[model samples]
Target: MSRFYEIDPTPENYWRAIILFGRNTASYKFALAKALLELHGNGKSQVKLEELAVPYAKHLAQHIKQQPKQITSKRSSFLEQITAYNQGQLDHDGLIQQTTRLGFNNVIDAFHKVHGNDVGSRFFIDQRRSHGGIELTDNLNHLLEQLSAEDLAGEVEARWRLVEEAWANNLSRQLMLVEYEEHDQQLIGIHSQRRISLTSARPALNGYQKGRCFYCYREISILYGSDTPADVDHFFPHKLKRCDDGKPIDGVANLVLACTDCNRGAQGKFDQIPALPLLERLHTRNEYLISSHHPLRETLIAQTGASREKRQDYLQDAYNCATVFTGSWQKWQPRAEGVAVF
Candidate 1:
């Protein structure tokens, strides 16, 4: 398996990597994702740019209503056209016409690039030169075999929301600090005295881990409808929260998604200090979070350390403290062997 799909080499993982790990210069990738899922549902293999523009522009328009700034760039004509359409300044036909001409400049070529590398699988073929739009590939159809269209689409939306919310909140200023709520297992954005519930910790964090349990690397779901939704686990056991001089154990750096069997089953690592190797994985995961654009990057930097070496020492110190409290053990092993997806 390639590094991108190391958890399980499936069509679904490839698709998830595209949505989860692709760089978001603008939210157009997400708009294209929403359009692809909608078009796929209608059973169209070949779609013209005009047909693609309708859903693509519509998704952008909807998002502009919620959050005006969709791109990191200072200005975007395509987004402005959508904003105009929402304001009744541009008609539907005008919006679609402009979208077909301006909206798909880069997303079609960049969709499959994950972490600066193109994934081995292709979800759509860009036929804009001769065919006018795109040709949905069999890989996309096989993805439906692995996961339902609704769930896959929800993952895209969740990731889009997470990034846009962080963008809107200006990362450098620390406008809002993200905090974990243990009672509900939700991440809250604190601004001054007001507390806003950002999103459920599962969907926000699931994509970075590539839809697998952090320990076992088994396939997991953030969908509430799934038979076994993964658990939002504390990487260091929650019981060790008091040992770190009151440093919050529930921060994004210390929380990971885990399968129920590995989290609380008979052979679970509940309240136990995980083997030392897992601490290195936690460090890697946190660095990945820092590399991403989400406010969780700021939260992790604040909770752990600003630099990589400091963060490494932070985890090392925490592990030493936890080992003193709860005796160290290397007995726990994941139910399956899987490579690191990140």
Candidate 2:
């Protein structure tokens, strides 16, 4: 069994729990929390319900704008509301009114539930006053102090690292990969408005891998209209361990360039763990991504954990889980010899 199965439910781990196991709506709550934290700074400041709504709405708008065209109806409605407000179709009063009608108050309510009622409730203290809206405990404020303002992405990555470390130190009966897949799906859904295509990050990935298939490490083409154009493969097969909502892990950490043959020929390997070599290659490729200063680096860190030691532990845990489910693990080899491991 992987050590990740035995993570203790500590306060710090509760933060990780919220990231990896919180409800889908928790994404909005997290964004709002971060925005509030930024606004609150190092003092014990209390923001009014109306004051919080402005930044929360702005944050949600930014999130919606970054998404692909296919979003939930609720998000689409909110998007429309924000668009009208931005276009001056709605004034400040109108915007606030629309926000109430659009169900943002529900998001706020959900945020409090996650922080107060969830298993990781120890991480936060929520005081709902009859008049002053909500008050955050000093404990929550102190915890936020340790986080960086690099962005919500960075804050999530940092918390994930903490969870990874906890798992590495203890072995439990439950698998962390299951929770990870759940979390990954929610994240993909939140950002699903944008699809990742071959043309999106191919240039950077091709250069980083020196034009080789990330898995097979076989020389591949990057040019358009080539007989053997590169295929974008999910490092973690999407078909296996698919989410209950039918969403697959389409995040940057799971995607990589592959040769046509390597991709199509690898059928029946869906959701199964790749050989140790592929796992090692994925780790190295992620390092390359980080070194290149690619935005995907943040995704990789969030999904795989931060630090080199934590990354290794995460892969091992994933491998252990896959092996248990499939009964055996298969190693992927290069079709031809002398293919370098990039």
Q: Which candidate is the best by TM-score?
A: 1
TM-score of each: 0.83, 0.43
Whole-model lDDT per candidate: 0.81, 0.49
Q: Candidate 1 lDDT, tens digit per residue, 298-338?
A: 77888888899999998988888887876764435666645
TM-score of 1: 0.83
CA lDDT of 245 in candidate 1? 57
Per-residue lDDT of 65 in model 1:
95
Q: How close is candidate 2 to the true structure, as a TM-score?
A: 0.43
Q: Write the per-residue lDDT of candidate 2 for residues 208-246, one digit (tens) a residue.
A: 444567766666665556665666667666543532222
